[model samples]
Target: MVTLKQIAEELGISITTVSKALKEYPDVSKKTRKLVRETASMLNYKPNSFAVNLRTRESKTIGLIIPVIVHHFFSSVIKGIIEQAEKKGYLVIILQSNESYELEKKQVDLLLSKRVDGILISLANGTADFKHLNDVIENETPLVMFDKIAKMVKCSKVIIDDRKASYKATQHLIDIGCKRIAHFRGPLLPQNSIDRFLGYKKALLDNGLEYDSSLVYICECGDMSFEEGKLNAQKLLKEHKDVDGIFINTDLVAIGAMTEFMKQGVRIPEDISIVGFSNWFMASVISPSLTTINQPGLEMGINAFKLLYKEIKKKKKNSDFSFKELVLDTDLVIRESTKN
Candidate 1:
């Protein structure tokens, strides 16, 4: 609660002198600057952020929107974003969309009303319209997207090559002698899901295997739950007796399918090999470890925030800013779920 007036009065100096000295204005003598800093520290003085923001026209705050908070991959991304944002002296206000387009739009409006300096988001699966996102750009707010994103939005993005990564995963299954392969794909709206499906189909055709629409199961809920995976696996079992392998959209879903398959007396790898995406930490510790693509969630978050921060600086300086698309690398981590 210490104020500049109190410090100036205590030092018998003008309030203007105290302010300039604390700001390192250079017009103040080094001796005066040192003394002012020492007094401010001894008094535990905290500057009025509102006043500072008024002068700089910056809130020193950023908004972050994600679909899920409890998931391991998203938790890592949150950690990375917080770490980077703190280093730059910015506070992050996180909002979960819960995979709903309505909630996502409302959160965007809330963040804008708060006058955030920038925004970083991973679009919800149900978000098909770009008007809300476009409004952020039109309002001159720095926007950066990551993971599940909209390609039509003119903004910076940080993501892994989902298509290429999914292709590599399907190819791995094929390499291990999986001719009759099935896919458990995510919801239809997200770009990643569409790209992954394309990659799976391409891999099948490239390997001289037939791509059957019946073999590809979709997660209609957009939540991509484990129960959905189990249901799809059950459906696959009832429909295709000769299916020997499966490529799942996510590790959580893959684990669900594995659990169901085991419950039905089906042996993994010996009967049906499985591969998944986003190598969650639990993937390695499960009974039959999952073979999946390492999606680099933490790195994606750090890079996304860095890009947003850069754009924020550019906006502050009235400098021309160019959008950037950053694609991080993904690795196929081989484990026990698939035959090697």
Candidate 2:
């Protein structure tokens, strides 16, 4: 129960120096680190792993890891997280995995080392291994997954049902007279992507449209970008010229596709009606407004933080961790990109 402040005072050093020394920060000399450790052991000081820094008992900090930082949806999510964390007097550390599993793992380790009170993450696109995620839980830190998440990882999560959302989007396309509908989906590893794909397939079956693998295109976007959308659209045009409707994974890609289609004299909602996921800001302002699914990034962020806060509080009180999965609702927005 020995605090870093007490150790610093006893060692006649600044609290910052004591903290840096304990963390072996490069700025802290080897002699200082050894002295701090020895003096701390002599004082029977034990660091609070849950609270992280003994400096102020709790670091009052949380780590947020996302796939893409610059994304409008993700940026909004960060805004929500920061606002909520600030209300509770907590600081947030934002890290972008750039959709790399390796980078995600390192970031997690860094957060742990820094002793953040909790962690909130949207799994990287390439994260197939759950060991890094498990390590946080195993270390008794409160961990919450949002948006892109893993099903096998036993922890709290907040997400909108991508499959159900995709189903509605596809059905809208079908309702609007899109017969030969094609899909541009995310990578196969993530659950949301898999769910969206299945939902697209199911909609086809239910509506009596034959499910064609040839019509489905996989995007390497991690989170589909504009260029990927355009490239895939070109392919979609060449390979499935008869396709009359398209359900895209994200708005940015959908825009990319729409741009490409326009270049070739394809009229929006005339030659091929289209639908997109995540009602991003640009979805509404484009040449022909994009029809999209409203994924509540801000609300998801607030709710995700609330969930993590609950678990963090529970851990601090010596209570056992109880996992909860909260699913938010998604709605389809009608736009000019699709048939009326």
Best-fitting candidate, measured by TM-score? 1
- Which predicted model would earn the best lDDT? 1
Task: List candidate 2 stretches off by more than 4 Å.
Answer: 1-52, 221-223
Q: Worst 10-residue stretch by lDDT in candidate 1?
A: 220-229
TM-score to native of every candidate shown: 0.92, 0.84
lDDT of 1 by residue, 138-243 (tens): 9999999999999999999998899999999999999999999999999999999999999999999999999999999999767888898899889999999899
Candidate 1 C-alpha RMSD relative to the actual structure = 2.2
lDDT of each: 0.95, 0.92
